[model samples]
Target: MKKNIESIFKAHLEPKEVYKGGKNIPPSDKKIYKLSSNENPLGASPKAVAAMKAALEHIDIYPDQTDMRLREALVKDFDGKLSAEQFLCGNSGSEIIDIILRAFINEGDEVIYSNPCFLPYSVFSRWYGAKTIDIPLLSPNYDLDVEGILNAITEHTKIIFLTSPNNPTGTYIPKSLLDDFLERVPKNILIVFDEVYRHFADAEDYVTALPYVLAGHNVLGLNSFSKTYGLAGQRIGYAYTTPTIANYIRLIQKPFLLPLTSIEAAIGALNDSEFIEKTVQTVLDGRKYLAQAFDNIGIKYWPSQANFFIIDPPLPEMEFTDRMMEEGIMVRPVSQFGAPGKVRITIGNQEANEACVKALLKIKS
Candidate 1:
């Protein structure tokens, strides 16, 4: 009668450690600057806040199962190059990734991604019983290893996950490199571009994956309102691809995947062009400020096109993180992302940026 619960769930007896983001320290009297998660320090759009408040009045009603309004809004945002049918909304970009895996991955299949990239690609692939392949990035610059990725492809390769302005490292694949890679990749293998940090990228040579989708290639571009629109808590994101692929993902997704408030808020956020501009500008400014400060202090950090950048601290990464926390600053130690002895810091508002620099100076002394 003690029975065997493990027998029923044998495949997941020893689950991998779940992916985590930055830490959230509890409230205290001292001012604590949280630059852990790459959130919009300027805060959410006023329009989005208003929309969410308005939606609360009808909290009992279920959201539209079709998600037509949001998809149409996205179409308009893209200037009609992408049809509404080509877009699929999800609770977040990460959830859309899971859905993509569910739609295409078979047991014993293979998925490939760059090492030190986003953690979810590996974690989710394993969850679906797909073999995960890690292609190490080019050293010194941490750029994606296109050739290595191409060499690793086998008949069993089902998907390729690429992150631009890659998490924990902040490096991006050049447009020319991506074009070359796309041409060589088999048409049957689905390619997913996780462009969650796309809005913050100002690299002159950077290219989005939308053009590939428009060209009828087997590619999907995933985006989020969380980082740019400050809608992380709302849990809304989307993917754009060919209508056929979008339909396949939609088939696997449960109805009412997102809440009513999140849909309305995303629509409102989409319309708030001024707010998005302000948020991007703030991050750009903070990036410059922090880079210069780090240089003055002789702290080594990467040149980033994203909202956060990785730094090589003089001390061990965990020790540096602990010291930062002691100074009422919370940053991410990115060993989990495959870059041990390195730390990732989000570009915050002017006040938070200055406080972070101050903490660095204190820690250095």
Candidate 2:
């Protein structure tokens, strides 16, 4: 008989709810507005839709092994400081996280990240048998604590994860603070910046770390087309880093990493600059409108730099979710992000935002 290998299996395989992409409740005939997931409320770029329709005719043919066109487009987007050789595409930002972890993390190594951050940081770290050093975000604003993170570092620390316009909280680390923090980190330790919501951030101090990558730092910027391009269903994301690191990640990636349709859709989305600009403007305007509505309704919410923000409702979270569903809206209860008594609300189209505000006022009253 074959010997049992269950004893050697990795521990703590309990699933963690990572991304809040709207719950899969029964398909009711009623129209349901999804304000749960941070998807683009404008729907996908029309160009992407058209490209996908064209790509349907070529599904039988295998995709190109190297995503040359997509990589070149991404490099051009960066304005020539970055080369096509210094990037890799993934099925999603989550897969990019896994690729980096697999490439660098070893047994008993330590990885540092903030609490209530992208949950995949902890899940994937534990999966690889690496110790997770989760530092709490500074109180009130949920800002990234550079001092706390620095204090948590040890000789065994292999990676540090930071997310700007962080999930659930919709907070970000200021560029000045980040510049100082980057200088203090050990040269050997890898710094991974997940800027999945970069396009939505309009705060004065918010900035991208691509310059650091250009200056030859051990930092990688992981981003997704899901939010900016409304292609969450397409599951396409990319990472920008040094060519050496990019080559290492590429070595461990799947043979046919991204589907042909997703590739075409991303290319199309990139071409539609007008659509992307309109989507960003809509989110910005809607954010201001919702903030005003929340103020008038007496609901407490975080000042957001991303397309979502955390709200503390008077009613219990599940009750709030149920009530919103009755009002034809779906919002995510985010006790999962360690913020009990609060929920994450994705900024949606003007109509959806107005509907959510109206529902909240009713619940509160």
Candidate 3:
């Protein structure tokens, strides 16, 4: 007897497509530049690399279940306002997203987020049988519509997920706007701030929600080492909140949450401020260069505070992506994020950025 898998998933049958990027192209004589995933072009820090190499020797032993040492190193970076007990390290920031939903969301609960924001918010909300309330972004800029979001809230609303320098759009919530929002929002509801791109943001008015967490609000700050430390492969990140909430998340998390290598690598990354500075500086410089190139070519693109930007090309977005790949450049077609006719490109190294601009200009001509 054949069992219907769709029937098993029931309403969840419509699978959410998780966009995978940074795939290695086949070896060729021509140079290939990967500008698809918003990875640090500077690559993993030397300290992280050294830490991983040292960890390999101790693979025979089990890692610390609580990730104590790594958490201790991270505590100092937060300037001692956040204690180590308030932090929980996971495989990735995305994993923490899933963990948060599992630990908090009940069936039929409501989770609100903006459309064209992080895809995972909707995807995982639905996966947990929670109703996903998607508010559309404000037009012309694709920024969050705080009023609309506040209007969508009800008694069933359990969580609110917000991303700064939102994925695919590169737009951020303003400080004053967020301050107003936090005050207006219900104090009982949990608010999650996904600041995975915080290190790359240089906008003068762009602010982080960590202050809320420190001020005894029901807020959680989620971050990853993948983008800033170039530790994507290492698969380690952290979530910061009140010790009360932290204890609950920790209780539900699977034991042996992160491997020894990931823990050590993360510790090494937190200790290497010089490398982080260099990576951020390179992306900042490359972002400016790409913006200028796009302007000179008359291509419409978002001026981003993140390591990536979305641009509307002359051709269809996917067609533009194909042409880019054919020219030995890889970028993300962001129609999946509800923005059709636009492609998102990561800010690569100077050489890669120049090559990508040349390819894009060639395709336009």
What does candidate 2's lDDT look like per residue over 30-137, in tens digits?
877898889998999999999999999999999877787899988778878899989889988988898899999888999998877777888788888898898988
Question: Which parts of model 1 are misplaced by more than 4 Å?
Answer: 1-3, 10-13
Estimate, for each residue in 165-261, the C-alpha lDDT of model 1 and write its tens digit. 8898988888999999999999999999988899889988899989999899999999999999999889898999999999888888787778999
**True-structure RMSD, every candidate:** 1.3, 1.7, 1.9
Pairs in clash, predicted candidate 1? none
Superior by TM-score: candidate 1 or candidate 2: 1
How do the residues 1-365 of candidate 3 rate in per-residue lDDT, one tens digit apiece? 89886667657536667745446666888888989888889999999899999999999998887777877887898888889999988898888999999998888899998867778888888888899998988889987889999999999999999889888899898899889899999988999998999988988889886888888889999999999999998888898999898988888878778999998889888889999999999999999999999999988998898999998888888788888989999898877776877888999999999999999889888
Error of 1 at 93 (Å): 1.0
Give the Cα-based TM-score of candidate 3 against the true structure.
0.95
Worst 10 residues of 1 by lDDT: 6-15
Q: Give the TM-score of candidate 1.
A: 0.97
Pairs that collide in candidate 3 are: none
| Candidate 1 whole-model C-alpha lDDT, 0 to 1 | 0.90
